[model samples]
Target: MPMPGKYSLQPALITVADQIGFLKQFFSNCFRKGFEWTEFFRQAYNVGYRSTGIIALTGFILGFVLTLQSEPTMKQFGATSMISGMVSISVMREIGPVIVALICAGKISSSIGAELGSMNVTEQIDAMEVSGANPMQYLVVTRILACTIMIPLLTIFADVIALLGGFTATNLGGAMNPWLYFYKATTALEFADVIPSFIKTILFGFTIGFVGCYKGFHSNRGTESVGIAANSAVVTASVWIIIIDAIVVQFTNMFVYA
Candidate 1:
């Protein structure tokens, strides 16, 4: 008889087979019925409206912290007065979007995962289907759409708050005419930095939302499964964000250098 080997592993092959089947079904539904918008609104409210406060707080303080932390570094370069412009560029191109995304991944992703997991555990999704409802449109589409719409909006708000935070932190360190600080910041901002940062956020938002929904929607366990689902959602979303960010950074550098 042939020796047993890793290629003969049952569980891994079974999982791959299951995922392929799930993908086929998921695509079939997407084409057959398209999607529903009203449910999307409901999920949008939960994902976007509910998480505003935390995003704002994080955005503001992140800006402030970055500015304060960089003072010594700027001073070392003998361009201490250039702090305002540096803060503005940093916040616009990188800090603002990344920080906001991380916050959303923690708050909104976990909430979505737990909510969907609970619905799964209680058989609500099953009942909806039995009642002639499309659970895919009702559950996944709306949630994904809301996240895609709201995350960029949140990123914009975060950019503004972070700039304000940087503004405040700059003044705290030394005396500078307020207008001068803003003037320098205004001049430093280029279309190159601002536009790509904003555009990349849409991808980040979709990735975070998609992974969270996919994980929770497929989760199976008991009532205790809810915890696992939520935890996994946060971890997966965060990991994806970091991975995507690194890739985006490399891509951006290539374009910049070219």
Candidate 2:
């Protein structure tokens, strides 16, 4: 048998394990039942509409900054003409996807965490339980489902804006001859690059939603826990994105080879 001290912390560990199990079950149930469309629309609006300005601005800056930064390098390579194609490729394949994910993790995850944490601390969740409602279904399912549905849309929108930014930035050197820039950018892109990227973002959305809800739902340390939940949500969501991305790349490559 374990020592008394060793066994003493077992309950806390068990609670954590139980919470993880609950999350998995919650996720399964949400997918199975199909989430509420009305609630989903509301939550999606919250996650997407509320954050539109930021995502657009970020995309714009990302495109502009990337072009500006690459101009000198491409010129050094004596390949200044490659700048538009290169920037568009980067934006669509990686920068737009990853950066938008990070931003959503920061903005949406924190908001969800704090909102849920507040509800938890205030006993609103308990009240729902007392009222004979599945709190997880009503709250967790809605937000998670919302993220799943909305993140991809947001990413696509960001990619467009980033491309626009790149176009505007390139115009600084000369009128980038819109037809050539668009053609090169489009021709250089393949389904492999575009499809894999958007697919990865679904998992990214799941991570942000899962971690945010998990932290907040389990946090009960009073008002203080709200802040803790928010902070942990952002941190965990961002970390999980990178870890999952690495795994996804390897796993996807195997499938491609297979």
Candidate 3:
């Protein structure tokens, strides 16, 4: 038998290997023969439509606060009129996707983890397995795909609403036409500014879904494991979102900005 100290390090290595295996299986299931369109649509509606209010509110407040904060600096430089463009670029390029994604991580990731954990604990997954239903396809694949589809759309929605919030803020200290504000905002953005950030949200969505599902689906059968799964899912998904954002931004900077 292994020494006590030697065995202590094994769990960490095993966990790392397990995570790698989970990722491979997730990707495989994603392309498996049976595509559950009905479940996908159902999950999409739940993840997307149900998330609108929070996204809108987050985008709005984010823009509102950023505009207010940047105003003093703009006024100091006598560039107050540039507020619209500044706010637009900031929201579209960074704030919108990251903030919305983090929020989704907190809200959707935890929900999915807890839901799956509860199902796992109750042996519902085993029941489904015995009844000829593929839980991985129905639950894991559908939710992951739904998140991947919905997050970018949500980010786009958030960006627009954020710009509207910025416009309102711009008008607070001085009068500016809505058309002029929108035009400035649009003109300030390029395909480069938009595309990479949009791409990041897809990764964010994938990370959120994968982490949540992995935590829940693999949770130990116990009443307390449900809470542990949800909590772990949120924390892990949020870290993955930040890490992915950093890596994507680094690549985008090298290629696009450099």
Candidate 4:
């Protein structure tokens, strides 16, 4: 006879296997017939344009606070003029992408999970299959592709907004030329700093979409499962974001920055 707790890992292992199968299905459906272009564009608009306000606010605050906090330390080191470069590099390389991705993981991921979970519970997904429609293409692929395409663009937008915010914070102490500040910031960023960060944001976006959809689609057939799916999506996506960021940073250090 098996021990009482011997099968504790079974559920986790099953979940991992299920997720892998779902990922495989997603890739397979990507190249299948009946790609939903309209849905894709709609999801893209919802994911990208609708998110600008929060991203802008977050970016501005991030840059402004970072500059203010670093001013004292830089002054002590007689590197006040390097503040713009420092802020730009920090935002472009690490802070901007990771922070924006986390925020999206909370907002976008939860929204997708709740929406899909509700559909699943209401039998809408089943109804679609009965109607001979590809729910995976219309729902999952559109959402996942939209997120994968939009997030990097959003991150770039956030980076620019952050630089402006940093400039605003810099001027609070004294007047500085806008052109000079921007020039310094731009010069501080290099090809190596940008490419890796961009790659990470793309991966972050995909992970966010995949986890959200998977949780929602596989949620139990109950109203309560919708909430659980949304919450789980946020938590799982956030954890994955951090893990991917750590792994990417390590690889970048080994290959790009080395």
Candidate 5:
């Protein structure tokens, strides 16, 4: 006889173990024979190019609003001249990567999960296996790799857009030269600030793709499970993004900042 509470964690433990195994398989297949370069490029286009509009819009709004909100506080301290630097550092170091990753976790993760889940439900994956096609290599590996590559690029794009937005917002308050604003923003950032954030975005992208693929690939055999998989993928990926961001920030503080 065992307490119900004792067994309550069993499901979670099993899920963790299963996910670890899946991750191991992914790494194993990632570098194996017959890499799908064409599929990888296609997925990269879908992941990166297709996402530009939304990322641009979000980044602009984020920078504009952040500048507007911080103006009053900076004025209070008489540090108004440092607004561009503040916005740039905040966006480049923290806000830009994290926010963009969360947005992608919602958009890209759900999209991948639903697409794969639908395939799983319709037995398309099974059919591929029957036809002796390497579906995992063609599908999962390409998608995950695309995400890993594109996400950092997207984050960099967002950071530029955000700085532009900040410049716009700053000009709205008073006249400022574009070159001067950009110069301040660029000078405020160092290699330490940019590289860590870039690395974080890469991890964020991999986590988003990995969670989405794992959930969809393991979804139960039903149409309803497709929805469940997509929803779960978004939630899980978002949670992991936050967790990874926190861990990275701690390590960065310890090693980089220190």
Candidate 6:
């Protein structure tokens, strides 16, 4: 007979296997016929357009605060003018993508989880199946694809706004010409810095969609489970964002730098 401790490990292993199966199914469904273009466009607008304000605000604040905090240290070394370049690299290569991804994980993941969980609980998803409507194709495929496409675009927008905020913060200390500040900022960044960050955001978006959909789709049938699904989606998605960031950074350093 297995020990009690060994029995406990069985469930965890089974859960991991089940999740892997779920992901495989999701990807297979994503490539099926009868793609919903109208729904995809609507979801894209919902994820990208509705999210612009919060992303912009977060980027602006991050840029402003990062510039202010780093300025004093640069001043100690009498290299305060390098702040523009430093902020640009930091925002573009690391801070902007990670922070925006975390924000999206929190907001978008929870939203998807709760929405799907509610539909699951109310039997709306089942009803669609009964009526010969493909819920997975219409619902899950559209949402996951939307997140995959929109988050990167949103990240680019955030990078631009963050640079603007950095410029404003730099001006607060002294008069720096906008053109010069932008030029320094632009020069500091290259494709090596950009391509990896962009790739990571795509992973982040996919992780968010997968976690949210998995949690909600598998949630227990109860009103309380809806909340649990949303909460778990956010928590799991955030953890994944960190893990993916670390892995991407490691690969980038190994290959891109080497």
The best candidate by lDDT is: 4
Provide TM-scores for the models.
0.86, 0.90, 0.96, 0.98, 0.96, 0.96
Model 6: colliding residue pairs:
none
Question: lDDT per model, in order?
Answer: 0.81, 0.86, 0.92, 0.96, 0.94, 0.91
What stretches of model 6 exceed 4 Å from their correct place?
1-7
The C-alpha RMSD in Å for every predicted model, in order, reads 3.1, 2.6, 1.4, 1.3, 1.5, 1.6
lDDT of 2 by residue, 142-209 (tens): 88878977888899999888878888899987887778877877787878778888888898888888
Candidate order, lDDT descending: 4, 5, 3, 6, 2, 1
Worst 10 residues of 5 by lDDT: 2-11
Clashes of each: 1, 0, 0, 0, 0, 0
Q: List the residue pairs that clash in candidate 4.
A: none
Residue range 70-170, candidate 6, lDDT tens digits: 99899999998789899999998999999998899889999999999999999998999999998888888888889989999899999999999999999
**Candidate 5 at 25: error in angstroms?**
1.2
Report the lDDT tens digits of candidate 3 across residue range 82-153.
888899899988989999999999999999999999999999999999999889899999998899989999
Error of 5 at 158 (Å): 0.4
* CA deviation > 4 Å runs, candidate 2: 1-16, 31-35
The residue ranges of model 5 lying beyond 4 angstroms of the native Cα positions read 1-7
The TM-score of predicted model 5 comes to 0.96
Error of 2 at 181 (Å): 1.8
Q: Is candidate 2 or candidate 6 better by lDDT?
A: 6
Candidate 5's clash total is 0
